[model samples]
Structures are given as C-alpha cells and as structure tokens.
Target: MTKAANFIWYELMTPDPAGAASFYGAVVGWTIAAHNDAAVGGVDYRMIVRGDGGNAGGVLALGADMLAGGARPGWLGYLEVADVDAAIDAIKADGGAVQMPATDLPVGRIAMVSDPQGAHFYIMDPIPPEDAVPGEGGVFSVTEAQHVRWNELATSDPDAAIAFYKKHFGWGQEGEMDMGPLGAYRFLQRGDVMIGAVMPLMEGYPVPVWNFYLGVDDIDRARAAVTANGGTITSEPMEIPGGEYAMNAIDPQGAPIGFVGPRKS
Candidate 1:
C-alpha cells in the first residue's frame, strides 16, 4: 500500500485548460501533454510533465455542467491513503463533510472531502501495477526543485483542523512558528518528512483552504514570468528562513498558486 498522508497527485480544474496550461508552462517551465480520457468515458485531461519526463500533476478542463453546479476554477491536492472508503468514514466521524463519496476510477478509488474547518483534499487509494513497488513515481521528492514543495492550510481553526487530519492521516506536529498577530503557524509531518503546515486564516485570505507551492529554481525570474504570461503576482517575492524566497500568484483564471525557490542574488 502507498504510504498514508503522502500527497501523491495535484490537479488543476479550470474553465480554460488550454490557457491555464499555457500560462503555467511558461511560469513554472513545465511541459504539458494532452491525455484523452475517452477510454474512461471522461473528459480530456492533461499531464504536467517535469523536465525529467516525470509527471508533476494534471490539468482537467471543467465542463459547463460542472461550472453550473458551482464548481469553480481551482487547484486540488490528492493525498494517498491505504483505504479510501475507510478514510471517508473516518473523516465524516470526525466532524468533516463528504464532498464526493468513494468511487472507483481507472487509477484508484477516490473520495473528495473537507475537514471540519472546510479545508478540502482528496483521499485516494491508487491502483498499482503488477511489478510496481510502493513509494515510487507518484509522489514528488523533497529534493526535486520543480515539483510541489510545500502545502499550507489557511483555516478557521488551526487546532481543530490539525486534529481532524491527524486522526485520519496520522500527521504529527513537527514544530511551529509565531506569526505574531496571525497566530501560530503549525508545521505538519508525515512520518519523518515535514509535508506542510496548518495555520489560522490570515486577514485577507478568502476562505479555509489548502494552498500548494511549486518549487522553482529562481524566484525572481519565476515572478517575472508569471506577470509576463498574463498571471498576477499577488505578493512580491519575500525571503524565508532558509534563504529561499516565495511569492503568491493568481492565474489568469483566478486560481491561486505559490512559487518557492532560491534567490538568484
């Protein structure tokens, strides 16, 4: 079984997949490959491939039906689990809501869910090949410079949110940082690896949600590429504790994303 609580996949659901793909390709230097889902009787999807030919994530075009049903443009992360159905049940029992029930797909059984504080994520039990081994290919490595590097949660109740996820995914608090008025930023770990953090929503953040950061080689250049490619840089690049820098951005379609990298200077 895949390791539980490891984020195995990332996806972007957008009204303009072609445009979003183009914009991201320029900003993050990813190569987009089109994948038709006709075999699965679903809409066309895309694979965001890294330079090494490994897939970083996917781009899914939202249909009119989905938009009419209130599905907006956004990015979602899929966390691997041992049992999707059992995970869904555990989430519900912990005051969380089931957005989509566990359903079988070509890749795995998946369930869309939200925590008690409304932070959304996916629980997936991925199908394995006969010769496949656990902990291979599906997840990005911490050393990978161009894949997803960090995940941040902006929630209504950081304490409750952390507890809800910990109960289901076995996440532990590694350590925390005081953000002064924004309260404490609690870092989360899966086993020994620090996967991300959960913190109270800041003043300007719209809602409780998970924000993913894509690692880049140069924060300054990536920030420029975002605006040059019709994306908006919401926050200018700022230095973090490790001497790395990060910036927040909004794609032309309005989906929020973040970039982290080493400063060229």
Candidate 2:
C-alpha cells in the first residue's frame, strides 16, 4: 500500500511580490530568491528561504488578470501522494470537486482539489520518491529549517470534511479538542504521523479555508519580526493550554498565515 501523503511545499498568491517577500523575510528570517522563469499565467514569482539558506516556500505575483478571474489571495498547501491519478479519482468519488485536473510539472504531477465542505489543497507526486526514510531527504527536513508541521482546515461542515479526507487520504481520527464556545477540533493522523487537522468554522465566517503553520524556534521573535516588516498581527501571542505559543498574521497583501513555536514541557 502507498504511504500516506506528506505535505512538502506551500506557496502564496498575492498582489505584491516585493512587499510579501520583504515581510516574510523579516518575520521568518527567509532569504528571498527571484527566478526568471517563475511566471505562471505571466505573473512573476518569488521563492522564500530559511535563514540557513534552505528553500522554505514561495510567493506569486497575483496580477490584475488573476483577480479579474475571481482568484483570492491565499496560501496554497501541497501534499505528496503516491499517485496523483488515484488520488484524484478517490477525491471525486468521495464527493469532493477537482478545481484543476491532474497536470504534469517538471517537478511532479499536481491536482487541485476542494473537499466536500470547500477547503482547497493540492496533491503531488514529486519527481523524486517521497517515502524514503528520514535523514535521506524524504518529504522534508527539520535540519534545513522547520518544515510544515501542521495544516488546519477551517470549514463550515467539519464532519463532512473529515469524512471526505478520511476516505480519500486514509487519515484516522485522533480525537477532538475543545475550543470553548468555538466547538470541537477534530485531529487526524496519517499512519503514526500527525500531519494536519480539521475544524468547524465559527459563526460569521465565510466559506471553508485552510491555514498553514510554519514552525519557528521563537514565537515572540517571529511576532516581533512580523510587526517590524509591515505585516499585521491578527492575534496576540499566547500560550495554548497545551504549552505551544502561536500568533496569526497577514502578509502585506492580506494573505492569512501563521507561525508556531515548540511547547516547553
């Protein structure tokens, strides 16, 4: 059987590439790299890196043509699957919609999918194998800077989202976490790995959306860097009851993202 999907890369589509690059560089200590052929639909792209010089993620220049077609500024998460065709079939069979059919890229094959509840994610089959043992550059590397540690899907129908993902991805339910009046948080596990999560959207929120969490060594420093770089901090830094410290923020173009520091036990 194929191993469960692993999240490998994330990219943000925003209106301002320079500003987004500057903001993220300060906040996450990323080194911004520009590519001559990074354009998709004719828009420029900027690559982000950790201070140690490893590629962390990417940002796209969302031009007017993109906005006119009804694209919103948001972060895109990529998960590694064993076979893109099989994943797309499972997704459609489970009632989810395919935003984009499987397309081949030099790096891998990719498909954009929306869950039954409307949260979007991309699945990929990297050119290189993804299930290689750790320390051998599997899907991601901790020594290169923190890889994606978690993905949270905020949706209107949490149960339906959970069912669809479980059917398509073979994720098992871990348990529910109480968020006071916000309702219950459902956690999922892939094999023995806890890759991401699903949660019901609170009242007054719009459609289902997914948020990506980038791991950091210091939460407070990350928060400070965000403010210093012209990004807005949507939430104040606070320790969750479980001991992790996190803060939500938006880049210069108003794309939602977050940073999390390890819990002190």
Candidate 3:
C-alpha cells in the first residue's frame, strides 16, 4: 500500500467535462477515456490517460446537487490515509472543517476536508487491485510531460496549516526559504522527494487552495496551446529555482491548473 499521507489522486470537478477534456487534452496531450464501469459512479467519471499509458487523473462533472450547494468548478487532490474515519476525526479535532462526511464510493471511502487555513483536499482509503504493487498507483516514475510534477499550497496561515497537516498526515518540513515580507515558503515532503511547498496566499487570490502543476515538454509551447484552446493564461513562463520554467492558467470551465517544463535556450 502507498503509505498514508501521500498524495494519491487528482480530480477535477467541472461543469463541462467534454470541454475540459478537450482543453486539457490539447494542453497536456492526455487521451480522455470515459469510465463506464457499472460498479463505479457511471457516465460522469472520465479518466485522464496519459500518452505513456499511465492514468494521470480523472474529470468529474459537477452534478446538480453540488451546483445547488454553491460548489464551484475546481480541482481536488486526494491524499491516501490508513483510516478515513480516523483521519477525519483528527482533522476536526485539529480545528479543520469537514465539507463532506466520510462516505463509501465505488473505489474507496473518502471524506472531503479543509485545513485550518481553508485549503480543501480529500482523505481516501482506496481499494486497489488484489495483485497491485505497493506504492505504484498515483505515483510517477519520472517527472515528465503529462504527469504531475509539483504540488503547491497557498493559505491564509502557513504555520497553522503546516502544523495541522503535520499532525494528521505525517508531513515533514524539509526546509524553507524566507521570502522577506511574505514570510517563509515551507517545503513539504512525504518521505524523500520534495512534493511541494506552502506559502502565504498572494494578493488577488480568490481563496486558499492547493494547486498541482502538470509537467510538459516545453513550457512555452504549453502556454501557446492553452490560449489557443479557449483557456486563459494567468501568468507567462517564469523561471524557478530548478532551472526550468512554469506558468499558471485557468481551463475553459474555470478550474485553475498549472504547467512546468523546460524552456528552450
């Protein structure tokens, strides 16, 4: 089993699944396949199959019930936990809030939760195949185009948010960088790999949330495709510490996503 507190799944809830599929297919070269398993949630679930034959993520249409409840189209990542109910209790005890109670789904039991600073994510106990290898599903062998390369969190209170995750998810602080008046940008690790960082929410951010960055072959090329395919480019390619570059954007259905890749010299 993949250890608890590891980010195991990514899902996008959008009002237009077809449009999102087409826009992201162009953006990341993913081949979208409808998940029609009768045991599963049926037609609303669509799998994002990467060009290399690995499952990247899934696209779920925001249903009527969610819309009536004021749920907006967005992306949600799932962190694997040993016990869903136990994790939910810990989250609540630590001053976090539960948007949805733990419930049984076709693939697992999951609960939607928000951190103390209000960034939303899920805790799931997934049901994998009987013969599946441990630590295989939802993990990438290499950082490449079409795979999730990084995870970033912007929150109102970075210290409290980090402490909350550390308590329940076993997340460790690898290191941090002081960004002057913006405070410290803290790197988070599941074990060895630096999965992402947590920082204070920047100006103009709608809300505190986690943003996952998908890798691409070329950041410039991905930016071009995004604007040409009905997506809005929020930021151009900017070089980061790792020698590569990244950009952020909103998909056609209003869900924000990001891309990271090399820039041709």
What TM-score would each prediction reach against the true structure?
Answer: 0.94, 0.86, 0.93
Between candidates 1 and 3, name the one with more favorable lDDT: 3
Q: Candidate 2: which stretches are off by over 4 Å?
A: 36-43, 129-146, 262-265
Candidate 1 lDDT score at position 130:
77
Q: At residue 202, give the lDDT of candidate 1.
A: 84
Top TM-score prediction, candidate number: 1
Model 1 residue pairs with clashes: none
| Cα lDDT for residue 91, candidate 2 | 80
Residue-level lDDT of model 3, residues 70-174, one tens digit each, is 988888888888888888887888888999899888888989999887899988888887876654565442367888888899999888888777778778877
* Residue ranges of candidate 1 with Cα displaced over 4 Å: 1-4, 130-132, 136-138
Q: What TM-score does structure 1 among the candidates reach?
A: 0.94
Query: Residue-wise lDDT of candidate 2 within 1-265, one digit each (tens)?
Result: 4465666778788887777777776766666665523433344766676766566767777788889998878898887777889888878887788998898866678899888887888888777546545312232432223455567889988888887767666778787889888888888787776666788896535888888777777788788788888888988776753577877888778888877785333
lDDT of residue 191 for candidate 1:
83
Number of backbone clashes in candidate 3 = 0
Cα lDDT tens digits, model 1, 1-265, are 2244778889888888778878888888787765545533467687788877777888878889999998888889998888777777778888888998888888788889998888788878888667666645454555456699888999999888887778777788878999898799899887888878888898777779999889888888888889998999889998876788889999999899988998886
Top-down TM-score ranking: 1, 3, 2
Could you tell me how far off, in angstroms, the CA of residue 61 lies in candidate 1 after the best superposition?
Answer: 0.6
lDDT of 1 at 120: 81
